[model samples]
Target: MDAAIEQPTVARLITAENREVPVSATLRYRAHDPLAVFVDFPAEAALDGEAVTWTFARSLLDQGLRAPAGHGDVRIWPYGGTRTVLEFHSPHGLALLQFQAAALRRFLQHSYQTVPAGQEDVGAVVERGLSALFDEV
Candidate 1:
């Protein structure tokens, strides 16, 4: 399996005033962090003019596709027949973004191909974390 996978897609930022702004986003999955997925946004999409990345459980994304999921930081739910809504909360504020359901589904499917569900190597993940932590000391 590849070390990482990245799927670039466009998302519509749902403004407070009920407007949609197109934004570029990427869905990323890493073999080292098999249980998690990441969403990367460009600096322009952030208020601070810095690139931002959000990490959340892969299971949360899978569940969110079918129904509402998450209680903190990240929340996702199906918006309608063809769109999905992702809500991200931070100390600064929150963002509401809508993405094509098909795009998300495709990305998730590709990620599963890289590291299938229920087949994540937990022992390797822990060992790598421990090694990195100790190396920093």
Candidate 2:
């Protein structure tokens, strides 16, 4: 199996003025981090002109595709019939992004192909995490 799956996509950033700006992003999932999904934004998308990555639960993305999900830093919900909205909050500020539902679904499907849902090797993930932590200590 592939170590990771990455899908490049274009997302619309909803500005405070209620305008949409196109942004480049990548959705990533790795077998090694079975429970997590990552969204990567390039430097041009950030105010500081530095790349940023946001990590959230894979299950959250799946649930959000169908309905509203998440209550903390990240929130996701379906918008209309064809779009999905993802909101991320940070100390710096908040970012609202819109993506095509079909695109997100496709990415999820590809990730499942690599590491099927409910079959994540959580034990192996834990072992690796602990090993890394102890090595740093």
User: All candidates' TM-scores?
Assistant: 0.93, 0.95
* Candidate 1 stretches greater than 4 Å from native: 134-137
Model 2 weakest lDDT span, ten residues long: 1-10
Q: Which stretches of candidate 2 lie over 4 Å from their true place?
A: none
Candidate 2 CA-lDDT value: 0.95
Query: Which residue pairs show collisions in model 1?
Result: none
Give lDDT tens digits, candidate 2, residues 8-108: 99999999999999999999999889899999999999988999999999999999999999998999999999999999999999999999999999999
What TM value does model 1 have? 0.93
lDDT of 1 at 102: 95
